[model samples]
Target chain A: MATEITVGVGLIAIGASLAVGLTAVGTGMAEQAIGAAAVGAMAEKEELFGKGLIMTVIPESLVIFGLVVAILILNLVG
Target chain B: MLRPKQMLKLTIFGPKSYMKQVIEELYDMNAVHIEDYTKKSDDDVFDIGNPLSDNEKHSDTLVKIRSLISNLDIERKNILPRETSFETIEENVTKLHSKVSEVMAKKEYFTRIKEIYTKKEIKKALSSLRLRFDDEFDYTSAVYFIGFVNAEIAKLKEDVEKASKKNMTFDSHYNGVKAIAVFTDHKSKDDVEKVLEDYDFSPIDNPVVKEHFRDLTSAPGQRFVKLDHEVKAVSDKLKRVNDELSELKGENMIFLLSSEKKLTMEVEKGEAPLKFATTKNTFLLRGWVPRNKSKMLKKKVEDVSNSKVKMKFEVPGKHEEVPIEFDHPKMVEPFEAFMELYTLPSYKEIDPTFFMFLTFPIFFGFMLGDVGYGLVTLGLFLFLKMKMPGMKNFLNAFIIASISTIIFGMVFGEYFGFEFFPPAYGEHLVDSLPEHLINALHMHPMESHGALVYPFPHLFSRSHQISDLLSISVLFGIVHILIGLVVGFINIFENHGIVHALEEKGGWIMIMPLIVWLLLEPLGVITGHVYDMLASILPPLPVLGIMFAVGAILTIIGEGVVGVIEVMFLALMSNILSYARLMAVGLASLSLAAVVNDLSGQMIQSMGIIGIIPAAIIMILGHGINIALGILSPFLHSLRLHYVEFFGKFYGGGGKKYKSFGYSPK
Candidate 1:
C-alpha cells in the first residue's frame, strides 16, 4: 500500500510537470513567430514598440494558463 | 476625464489681402489644427491659394541661416535663444553669410594646395632615380622613360642592350620596387620600349612635375624644403580661417538661432494661404479648434483682420473623424504616455488613461512586492526623474508603480524576502507588540525556547501562502476583467446603442458571475465555512447554468458561433487565467531573493571572517541583478496585462493626436 501511494505521488508529479512543460514549449513556439514579426515591425516604425510588445507576449497567456493548471493539480490532487 | 476634449470644426474666409494677417493671428493664438485643402477635380469654383508675398524672401533667409548653423556646428543647446528683430536679423544674416562664404572659400583653396603637395610618392620616385629638379634631359636626341619597374636592373640592361644592339643607356635604383631611367636613340626607341614593356615599366607624368616646380631652379631636396615651407604657410592660413569661423560662430550663434526661429515662423505664416482654397479675390480656410477655444480663435482672427474675415464654427457630425486630445487631470497625465506608446483612444471612444493610472501600478507593485527592492527602485526612478526631464512622464509612472510596490510589500510583510526584517535582526518588532493587537492582526505567538515570539502580522506570506496568493490573483483578475467588460459596454453603448452593447459586452458581464461562482466553489471546499456561507447566498448551480446558457446565446447573437467560442473559451477563460502571472512572477522574485539570502547567509556562517568578502559581493551582485529584473519584469508584465487583456476589450484605438498649428515641439 505504501509503494502504491509513492507510485501515485510520482505519477502526479509527472502529470504536473507535463502540464507546465508542454504548455511552455507551446508558448515558446507561438512567441517565436510573433516576436520575430513584432521586431520587424518595430524596426520600421519605432512607435510600434508597445504594440509589438503586446503582440509578442499575447502567447504568454498560454504559459500562464499552464502554470495555473499546474497549481490547481498540485493543490487538488497532490 | 474619461473622454477626449470636444472639438468644433472651424471655417474662416477672408479677402485675399487679409490672408497674411489672419494667418499671423491664428499662428499667434496656436489654437487651430488646419486641414489642408485638396482640390476636387470636379470642382472649378476654387483652387489652392498661392502663398503670401515675401514668402520667398523669408524662406531664403531661413534656409541660409540653417546652413550657416550646420556649417559652424553650432548646436542649439550651446546657445541661449534670444529675441532679435527682423530688421537686425536681415542685416546681420547677410553680413554673416558673406563673411562665412569668404572664409570657406579661402579654406577650400588652402586645402586643395595642401592635398596637391602632400603626395610624397613623387618625391620618393625622384629620390630613387637619383635625380634633381634642375637635372636636364636631352629629349631632342634621346627618348627617356623614368618611373617604376618590376624587373632586375642587370637583366633589364642586358635585355635592352640585346634589343637595341647596345645603343641604349640605363641607370637604375632599387627601393622595395625598382625605379629606372632609360635613355635611347630614336631608331631603337621602339625596340627599347618593347623590351621595357616586357619588364612591366610604368612612366610618370612629366607635366605635373613641371607645373609643381616650374619656377624652382634648385635641387630636389632644396625644392622640397621650399614646398614644405609653403605647405606650412597654407596650413597656417587654414588654421587661422578656422579660428575666424569659430569666433564668428560664437558671436552670431544666438542671433542666428533666434533669426532662424523667427524666420521659420514668418515663413510658416507666409505659406499658410497655400493650404487654403481660394477664388479670385477671397480665400477660405477650414480647420478644427477645441470647443471652448472657438470663440477666442474667432475673436483673435477678427481683431487681426479688422473684421474683414468671416468665421463659422459648427459641431462635428457623427461620421466625422476628429483628432483626439486627452483631457486628464495633472496626476493622471503621465499615464497618457502609455496610451501614446500604444495608440490613443479614438475621439468617440473612452480614454482608458485614468483606468490604467489606477490599475497599472497596482499590478506592477503586486509582482515586485518587497520593501527593500521597492525603496531601491523608487530611489532609482526618482533619481532618473531629476536627471532625464525629457522622460519625466515615463519615469513618473514607474515612481507611482514603485510606491505601490512599497504598499504591497507592507501587506506581504516582506523586507527583501525576509519576514518583517532580515534574520540578522535576531527578533522582529512584531514579537514585542501587545497581545490585543497581535490577536486583532490574526497572528499567533509561538514559544521560542522560553520567550513567546509573535510572527509579523502580514496579511499574506507570499512564499508560504502559494494557494492563497493564487486564489487572490485570480480574484483580482476577475474583478479587473469585469471592469474592462463594463467599460466595453459603455464604449459600445455610446457608439452603437444599448441593444448591441448588451449583446456584446453585457453577455460577458452576465457570464462573469457564473465564472466567479465556479472559481469560488473549489475554494469553498478548501476553506470550508466561507464557501458554505457564499454557497448559501449565491444562486444554485442549475440557475448559474441557465445564466451561462443565456449569456452564450447573447454572445452568439452578437458575434456568431466564432464569437461565442472566442468570448467564452478564449477572452473570458484565458484572459483571466493570464493574471496568474501576477502570482507566478511575484513568487519567482521572492524565491530568487530567498535563494540569494540563503547563499549569502551560508557563506557568512561557514567561512568565518574571510567569508564576509564573498558574501558581501554575492549579496550586492545578486540583489543588484534581482532588483534590475524586478523593475523590468513587473513593469512589462503589468503593461502587457493592460494592453493585451484590459485594453483589448474596449479600446478601438487609432486616434489622430491633436497637434495645433504654430506649436513647435520642444
Candidate 2:
C-alpha cells in the first residue's frame, strides 16, 4: 500500500511535468504566430497594441489548462 | 402557377449613346470602376502623347529654372501653387520649368570644363602661352573629385549629344588643385585660353588665378550645404510662375450658366427610375421599382416623361427570399421549434451561425470543467453574456456549455476540489465530528466515490466502470433525440396536419417506449406483461398480431402504411442505437481521464526520488490539459449524438433565417 502511494506520487510528478512542458511548447508556438500577426498589425496602427496584446494571450489558455491538470494530479497523488 | 417572379434583372442597348448614362447610373448603384492612368505615365514619354515642339519647350523651360534655382534661395512655400487656372498656370509653370533646366545645364557645363582643365593640361597650356608655373600645392587628389564631376557631366553631355548632336566646350581658369570655368561657343582648350588672355593677361601664379582656383576648390565642397538656398530660389521662381497662373484662373474658371436647364437624360431597362442624365439624341432609363407596382411605374414614367424618353422593365436583386403573403405564422414556428430541440440547425441546410453555438460550449467547458473550474467558467460566461454590451449572445452560449459541465461534474460525484460525498463522512463524521462542526457537503477524495452509489448500480459498482458510463451517455442521447422528434412533430402537424405528424412522430414515440420498457424490465423496477410483450418485439415479435391489429385500425381510421412502417423501422433499430451516445461519451471521458492518470503516473515512476517535484508538476499539468480536452470531447460527442444519430431520425433542417434589410448588419 505504501509502495502504491509512493508510485502514485511519483507518477503525479511526471505527469505534471509532461503536461506543463507540452503546454509551454504548444503555447510558445501559438504565441509566435500570434505575435507575428500582432507586430504586423502594430506597424499599421500603433493604437491597436493593447488589442493585439489581448489577442496574443488568448492561446495561452492551452498552457493554463495543462497547468491545471498538473495541479489536479499533484493533489490526487500527494 | 402564374405568380410573377420577383427577382431583379435589367437590360440595355446602344453602346455609345448609353455608355455615359450607364456608367453614372452604375456609380449611383455603388458599383466601383477605378481608372488606371499610371501605366501610361511610366511607359515611354512619346507613347503618353506629346509633340516634339511641346517636349522641347518643356525641357528648355526646365533647364532655365534649374540654373536660376541652383544659384538662388527660396523657401518651400514659394514654389507650390495655392490654386490656379489650368491654361495660365500651364504657362507660368512652363517658364519656371525652363529656368530649372537652364541652371542644370550651367552647372553641368562648368563641372565638365573644370575636369578638362587638369594639372597636366593646365601646365602644358601655361607653358605654351609663355606663362611658366610650378606646383606649389598638392593637386593630384582634386583630379579624382574633378574626374567624378566630369564623368557626371560627360554622361549628361552624351545624352544631349545623342538627342540633338550639339557639341559642348567651355573656358577654364586653373591654379593647381582648383579651377574656374565658363561654358560658351568655344570649341577647345586653345580657343578658351586665347579668349581668357584677351580678357586679362596674367601669369600662372597670378593672384586673380589663385583666387579663382580657391573659389573652384570650395565651389563643390558644400554640395548639399546650399540645398536650402537652391530650394528657396526654386520656390521664388515657382511663385512668380504661379502668380501669372493665378491671374488666368479668373479667365478660365468655368461657371455653368445653363446648368439647371440642361436636362439629365437616363437610360435603363425594367422599372427602376433613371439614376443619371447624359446628353443623347434619345433618352433611355431603367431603375428598381416595387415588384407589384413595377409594370405600372414603367409605363407611367415612359408616358409622362414624354415618349422621347424610352423606358424598360427591371427587377431588384434579392440574395434572399422576400416576405410574401404565403409565409404564415405556422411556417416560421418550425424553425424556432427545431432550434429549441437540438440547440442547432440540421446539416441539410448549411448555416454557419449554428456552428458557433455547437462549438462554443465545448470550448468553454474544456477550458473550465473541474467543480472549481466549472463555477469560474459559469461565472465568467454569465458576467460577459449579461454585463458586457457586445458579447452578450456569444457569452450566453458559453454559459450553456458551462452549465452542462457543472451537471456532468455533479453526476461524476465531483465538487470543489473533491467529489459529491466524502467516504469518511459516514463513518468519521457521524462518530467524531460534532453536529455543529460537521459540514454536509464537505468530503475527502477517498470518501466521495464510496458514499454515493453509481447512478446505474445494476451495470456498475465502481464509479468508473465503462458500462455504467456508457449507459448514462446513451440515456442522455435517447432523451435528446426524443426531444428533437417531439419538436419535429410540432412542426409537421402545423404544416401538414396530424396525418403527416403521425408518420414521423409515431416512429420515434414507438421506439422510445419499447426501449424504456426493456431497460426497466431487466432491473425489475416494473412488473408487467407489457414489458414481456415489448421486449419480444425486438427479436421474435410474437405480438405481431397485436401490432397488425393496431396498424390496421390506425391506418383504416387515420395515418396509413407510412405510419406503420415508421413505427416498425424506427422502434426496431434507431431507438436502441440512439442510446449509443451514452456509451460513446461516457467511455470517451473515462478513457481520456484514465490515460491522463496513467501516462502522468508512468512519467513520475521512471524519475527517481530527485524527480519528486518534477513528477508532481508533470501530473498536475498533464491532467489539467487532459481535463480541458476531456471537457470538449463529452460535450461535442454528446451534442453530436443527439443532433445527428437521434434527432436526425425526425428532423430535416432547411428553414430560412430571417433577415431585415433596412437594419444595420450585425
Candidate 3:
C-alpha cells in the first residue's frame, strides 16, 4: 500500500509537469503559423500591427490555463 | 456614441464661369463631402462634362519649383507661409532655376573636356619619349611595349638577369614605377616578355599618338597632375553652385511651400467640373453636407461666388447607402482606433467603440495588476504622445488603459510582486530583500505590533487561490458573454425587431446564466458553503433541463433548427468558455512577477550585500521583460476579446467614411 501511494504521487508530479510543458508546446505551435502570417500582413500594411499583435497572442491563453492546472496539481493534493 | 451623426445631401448649381469660384469656396469651407456626378447620364439636363483645363502657368511654375526644391534638398517644415505675391515668387523661382542650370552646365562641359584633353596630352607626352613609336623606328625589326609593372626598373633589372637567357638590352627611366617601356629584337621578344611576366608586368595600351609633346621639359608622368587639377576645378565650381542653391532654398522655403499648396488647390478646382454635371452655360454639383455645418456652407458659397451659385438640399432614401461621420466626445474618441482595426460599423448599426473603451481598459488593467509596471507604462504613454502627435488615437488607448492598470495594481497590492511589502508577511523571503527595496516603490513593508497591515487590500489575488480564481474566471465568463448577448439583443430589437431578438439573442442571454449556475453544482458540493447557497436558492437539475429545452426551441425558431446544434451548442458554449482567458492571462502576469521577486530574493540571501547587485540586475532584466509582455499581452487580449468575441455579436461594418472635399497646405 505504501509503494502504491508512492508511485501514485510520483505519477502526479510527472503529470503536472507534462500538463504545463505540453500545453506550452501546443501554444507555441499554434503561434508559429499565426505569428508568421501576422508579420506578413503587417509588412503589407503597417496599420495592421494592432490586429496582428492581438491575433498572435490569442493562443497564449492555452498555456496560461495549463499553468493553472499544473499549479493545482502541484499544490492542492496531499 | 452609438450612431453616426446626421447628414444632409445638397445640390449646388452655378454658372460655368462661377464653377471655379464655387469649388474654391466649398474647399475652403471644408464641410461638404462630394458625390461625384458619374452616376448621372449625359441625356439628363444635369449631365456632367469633362473637367476644364488646368492653369498652364500654374502647372509649369509648380514643376520648376519642385525641381528647385529637390535639387536644393530643402528640409520641409510646417512653417507659416511668407507673404510674397504669386508673381514675385514665380519670377524668383525661374531665375533660381536658370542660375543653377548655368553652373551645372559649366561643370558638365568641364568634365567632358577634361577626359578627352587628358588622354590626348598623356599620348603626346609618351610620344616625346622618342625611345619607340617614332618615325626613325622600324616596326618589322623590333617591338615596343609601354605599361606599368609590379616591380620598378631597379627590381626588374635583377629579375630580368635571372629569368632571361635572351640577349636583350635594358634601360631604367627616371624612377619609372608605373611607366615601363620595353624594346627587344622580334626573334627573342616572346622570351623577354616571359621574364617580364615573372615581374608581374602589365602593359598599358599604346594608342596611336598622331601628335608629339608640345613642351620639351614636360614629363609624361606629370600628366596626372594636370588631369587631377582639372577634376578639382570642376568639383569646386560644382560645390559653389550647390552653395548658391542652398542659400536660395533657405531664403525662399516658405514661398515654395505656399506655391505648391496654391497650385494643388487650383488643380483640384479645375478638375471639379469632371465630378459635377455641367451644360454649356451651367454646371450642377451634388454632395453630402453635415446638417450642423450646412448653414455656414450656404453662407460661404454666396459670399465667395457673388451669389451666382444656387443650392438645394434633400433627404436620402432609407435603403440607400450614406457616408458615416462619427461625432464622439474628445476624451472617448481614441477608442475609434480599436474600431477601425477590424471594420467600420455598418451605416444602420450602432458603433461599439464606447463599449470597447470601457471593457478594454478593465481587462487590460486586471491582467497587468502591478503598480510599478502601470506607472512605467503610463510614463511610456506620455513619451509617445509627446513624440508623435499624429499617432494620438493609438497612443491615447494605451494612456487610458494604463490608468486601469494603476488602479488594479493598487487593488492587487503588487509593486513588482511585493518587493515593496514588509518582510514579516513571508519569513523565508525576509533575508533576501535589500533595506531600501522594502520601502521602495513608495510603500513601506513594516509590521505594526502583533497585527499585520497590508499596504493595500487584495480584493482578488492572482497569486493565491488558484482554484477559486478559476471559479471566478468562469463566473466572469458567464457575465461577459451575457453582456455580449444583451448588446446583440438590443441591436436586433432596434434594427431587426423584437421577435427575432427574443428568439435568437434573447434565448442565449437566458440560457448562459443558468448553465453557469448549474455547472457550479459539483464545486458547491465539494466546498459545502456554495452547496448550501445553491440548495437554498436554486432548483433541481430538471429545472435546468426545462430551461435549456425552452431556450433551444426559441433558438430553433429564430435561427432555424440547425442553429440550435451549431450556434447554440457549439459556438455560444465555446464563446462563453473562452472568457476564462481573462483570468488565465492575469495569472500568467502574476506568476511572472512572483517568480522574478522570488528568484531575486533568494539569490540576494546567498550573496548578502554584494548579492544586492546581481539581484538588482536580475530584477531589472526580468521585470523589463515582464513589463513589455505585460503591456502588449493584456492590450492585445483586451482588443481580441472585443474584436473576435464581443463585436462578433451584433456588428458588421462596411460603411463608407465621410471625407470633406477640402484642401489644407500640406
Candidate 4:
C-alpha cells in the first residue's frame, strides 16, 4: 500500500510535467511556422501587423490549456 | 448608448455660380456626405465638376513643397499656417527647385564617378603588379587567364593539359586560387575551362587585358588618384547644398502644409462641377447632409453666397441605406474601437459597444484577478497615459480593466498568490477591512488551517472550489449571452415585430434560463431555497423535461428543425464551455505565481544568505513572464469571447461608417 502510494505520486508528477512540457513544445512548433509566415506577410503589407499578431498568438491558448490540465492533475495528485 | 445615433439623409441643390461658395460652406459645416452624381442621361447630365481654374498650378507647387517637407523630416509644432503669397511661393520654389536639381545632379555625377574611379584604381594596381612570364605578344589563338591559383596548381595544370589534349604551360605566382590565371589555347579553352571548374578557378576583376601589370598601370595610376580627389570635393559640396535645402524646408514647413490644403480645397471645388447637374446657366448640386445640420447649412450658404445659393432636405427612400454613426458615453467610447474592429452595427442593429464595455473588463478581471498585478498594470497604464496623450483611448481601456482586476483581486485576495492573510486570519482580515472592500474581495480560496472565515462572506474559494468557479463561469457566460439574446430580440421585435423576433432571437432567450435551472442543483445551492421551492413546485426531472420540450419547440419554430436539434445545441454548449477558459487561465497564472514563490523560497532555504540574489532574479523573471501572460491572456480571451461567443448569438454587422466633409487638422 505504501509502495502503491509512492508510485501513484511519481506517475502524477511525471504526468503533470509532461502535460505542460509537451503542450509548450507543441505551441512552440506551431508558432514557429505560423510566426514565420506572419512575419513574411508583415514584410509585404505592414497593415497586416494586427492580423499577424492575432494569428501568432492564437497558439498561446494551447499552453494555457496545458496549464489547466497540469493544474487538474496536481489537484488530484497533491 | 444602446442604439446608434439617429441619422437623417438630406439632399441639397444650388446654382452653378454659387456652387464653390456652397461647397466651402458645406465643408466648413462638416456634416455632409457628398453623393457623386452618376450619369443617367444622354446629355452629360451627371458629369463631374471641373477643378478650380488655378488648381493645376496650385497642385504643381504643392508637389514640390510637399516633397521638400518630407525630405527634411520636420515635425511642425505651429497650429496656424504662415500665410505666404502665391508669387513668393512660386519664386522660392522655382529657385529652390533649380538649386536642388543642380546639387542632386552634381551628387549623382560624383557618386557614379567615384564608384568608377575606385574600380579603375583597383584594376590599375592589379595591372601594375609584375608577372615573371612573357608580356609583349598577344597569342593569335590562345588566352592568358592570369588569376590566383591554389597550392595544388601543378595537379590542376596536369588536369587542364590532359583534358585539353594540347600543350599547356603553367605560369603564375602562388597566392592560392585568387592569384592563378591560366593561359590556354582557344582550341582548348572550353576543355581547359571545364577542368578549371573543379579546381575553383575564377578570373580576377580586370578581365579584358593581359599584359605586364606594371607597364599597364604606371601612367594611369596618377589619373585614378586625381579622380578620387574630385569625388571627395564634389561629395562635400553636395552635403552643403543638401543642408541648405533641408534648412529651407524647416523654415517653410507651415507654408508647405497651408499650400497643400489650399491646393486640395481648390481641386475639390473645381471637381464639384462633375457632381453637379448643369443646364446652360444654373447648376444643381445634390448630396446627403445630416438632418440637424440641414437648416444650419442653408443659413450658412445663404450668408456666404448672399442668398445666391439655395438648399433643401428630403426623406430618403425606404430601401435606401443610410450611413451609421454611434453615440457612446465618454467612458465607454474606447471600446468602440473593438466594435469598429469587428464590424459597425447596421442602422437598425443595436450598437454592441456599450454591452462590450460592461462585460469586457469583467471577463478580463475574472481571468487576471490579482492585486499586485492589477496595481502594477494600473500604474503602468497611468504612466503611459501621461507619456502618450494621443493613445488615451488604448491606455484608458487597460486603466478601466485594471480597476476591475483590482476589485476582483480584492475579492480573490490574490496578491501574486502569496497568502498575506491566510485562512488562519481570513475572518480577522475580512472584519478588519471595510464592508464594501470585504465584499469586493473574494478571499475564500486560501487554505491555511483552522475554520476558514469571512466577515462579509465570499462567493467561493478558488483553491478549494475549482468546480464551483467553473460552474460560475458558465453561469456568467449564460447571463451575458442571455442579455445579448434579449437585446437581439428587442431589436428584431422593434423592427420586424413578434413572430419574426421569436423566430430570429427570442427562442434563445427562452432556452437559457431553462438550461440553467435544469442543468444544475448548484444554481439552487447558490440562490438558497428560492430554486428549491421553484423545483418543489414542478418536481426536478419533470421540470427539466418540460423546459427542454418548450425550449426545443421554440428553437425549432425559430431556426427550423435541424438547426434546433443539432446546430443550436452544439454551438450553445460549446460557447458555454468556452467560458471554462476564464477559470482555467486565472488558475494558471495564480498557480504560476505560487510556483515562482515556491522555487524562490526553496532557493533561499538551500543556499542560505547567498541565494537571495539568484532567488530574486528568478522571482523577477518568473513573475514578469506570468504578468505578461496575465495581461495578454485576459485581453485576448475577453475579445475572443465577445467577438465569437456573444456576437455569434445574434449580430449581423456590416454598416458603412458615416464620414462628413470636414477640415482635418494637418
- lDDT values for all models: 0.78, 0.41, 0.69, 0.68
- Reference-based TM-score, model 2: 0.38
Q: What share of the true interface contacts does each candidate keep?
A: 0.57, 0.00, 0.46, 0.07
Error of 3 at B348 (Å): 1.3
Please write out the lDDT profile of model 3 over residues B127-195, one tens digit for every residue.
Answer: 434443546555436565554344556777665545444333334332323345665556656766887
lDDT of 2 at B49: 15
Clash pairs detected, candidate 3: B48-B277, B48-B278, B147-B204, B422-B445
- CAPRI quality of model 4: incorrect
DockQ preference between candidates 1 and 2, better one: 1
Candidate 3 chain A lDDT trough over 10 residues, lowest sum: A1-10
Q: Best DockQ goes to which candidate? A: 1
Q: What TM-score fits each model?
A: 0.79, 0.38, 0.73, 0.73
Per-prediction DockQ scores?
0.45, 0.04, 0.38, 0.13
Residues B561-621, model 2: lDDT tens digits: 6656655554423444434434433444445555555555566678767667775776577
- Sorted on TM-score, best first, the list reads 1, 3, 4, 2
The prediction achieving the highest lDDT against the true structure is 1
Q: Give the Å shift of residue B338 in candidate 3.
A: 1.4
**Residue lDDT tens for model 2, A1-78:** 233656767777899899878988998999899999999999999866645665565555456446545544654653
Looking at model 3 chain B, report the run of 10 residues with the lowest lDDT sum.
B207-216
lDDT of 1: 0.78
Clash count list over all predictions: 0, 71, 4, 28
What value of lDDT does candidate 2 attain over all alpha carbons?
0.41
Candidate number 2, chain A TM-score: 0.84
